[model samples]
Target: MRSHHSLTNKAWAEFHVDGLPHVHRVFPNGESTMAIVDGLVHGDYVAAAVNDTAVTLTLFSWPASSISRYCYAIHLQIGRVEGPTGRLAVCVQVTAAREVSPVEDYWCMTVDERVALFDRGNAHPVATFRLEYENQRTVELPK
Candidate 1:
């Protein structure tokens, strides 16, 4: 068997992306998508603690600059997971679950909601997720 290592060495390193001139909309509520960025691993992101059940990267737009490449820092309750080894997954809830609309549709929300959503922070989820592990966070702590 192989040893599962906690994420103690990797981080969200830098990456570059190209955009489409025809696809201009670049927000959670926008429909215009020029390209998609996926296939990420633990060595791709740098979180503070706890290995995770999964990780994924969802890009909505071509970053304006390297400073806006995209990253996140979520607090996962690893100790609370319970399920069969055959099926362990993580469920990430996007803000305004119901109000979420199709890519071509406009989002319905108050100005404050939009402002908060666009506000810059240490973590910027690219409209979705990306798993960042090789063996996966399959630690089976005693129930």
Candidate 2:
């Protein structure tokens, strides 16, 4: 039987974007903000360390720069809130879900990779998360 190495590797390396961060309409017009996680380059990966274990996620994004002459597409795999500045509830909640699976998740703006090499050679932001879901500190039991 073929070893499940590939699946195992994908599990720990790729991100499962359970929810995409969205702006909250209730907040004041000026208070609301939205930024696309740029995904214009390969090897440009992001991750999130929730409890302590690193979790993988899928990535998607908008078009590349305007100077490019050829058409292009984009892909993304967001992990954590790199440096969120707006309200936590609306700005970073969805982007920071505890559990995310493909069976029960929906994302906006699915990368319509119509043109090839759209997100090529561009810089993108990344996020990381630990698996642990608590706020406990470590302490030596006894020497």
Candidate 3:
């Protein structure tokens, strides 16, 4: 993800995705928001995470589809947010048809339900990365 940090506002970070037509912003308190850059499609924020190093967000979108008459496309975005820095870690696009309909309305589903749907193993990873935190001082021993 390409990020732009404002020199004046240390708590503000803004970034955009390559294919997606949206600009995502992360505030100082680890809250994230998105604006439609092109105004062509709509999206919704599904979940978020805050840690010592980063704040992560998950966004969901249902794009139009021609192959599946009954089902729409599923687009999942996983992004990270740190103080004045944000990154789009993973973008998952599921276009294949499913045996059972996932839900009636994605927006109506609870956060836990939405998270479960994302983790249902329908989408496979094309690549994986091993991340190491820079500020780590020690490893916790498993008791």
Better of 1 and 3 by TM-score: 3
The per-prediction CA RMSD against the true structure, in angstroms, equals: 15.6, 17.7, 12.6
Candidate 3 lDDT over 47-76, as tens digits, reads: 334444433344443323323322223445
lDDT by residue for model 2 (33-130), tens = 12323522222222333332223333323323333222222223223333433211111211211111121211232223211223334533344333
Where is model 3 more than 4 Å wrong at Cα? 1-41, 68-99, 102-119, 126-143
Superposition error at 137 for model 1 (Å): 22
Candidate 1's C-alpha runs over 4 A off are 1-52, 56-58, 61-81, 96-117, 120-143
Q: In candidate 2, where is summed lDDT lowest over 10 consecutive residues? A: 89-98
| TM-score per model over all chains | 0.20, 0.20, 0.31
For 32-100, candidate 1 gives per-residue lDDT tens digits of 322333521111111222344433322222222333333222322222235543444443423211112
**Which is the winner by lDDT between candidate 1 and candidate 2?**
1
Tell me the lDDT of model 2 at 116: 23
Using TM-score, give the best candidate's number.
3
Candidate achieving the largest lDDT: 3
Worst-scoring 10-residue span by lDDT in model 1? 39-48
Candidate 3 lDDT score at position 84: 38
lDDT against the true structure, per candidate, is 0.29, 0.27, 0.40
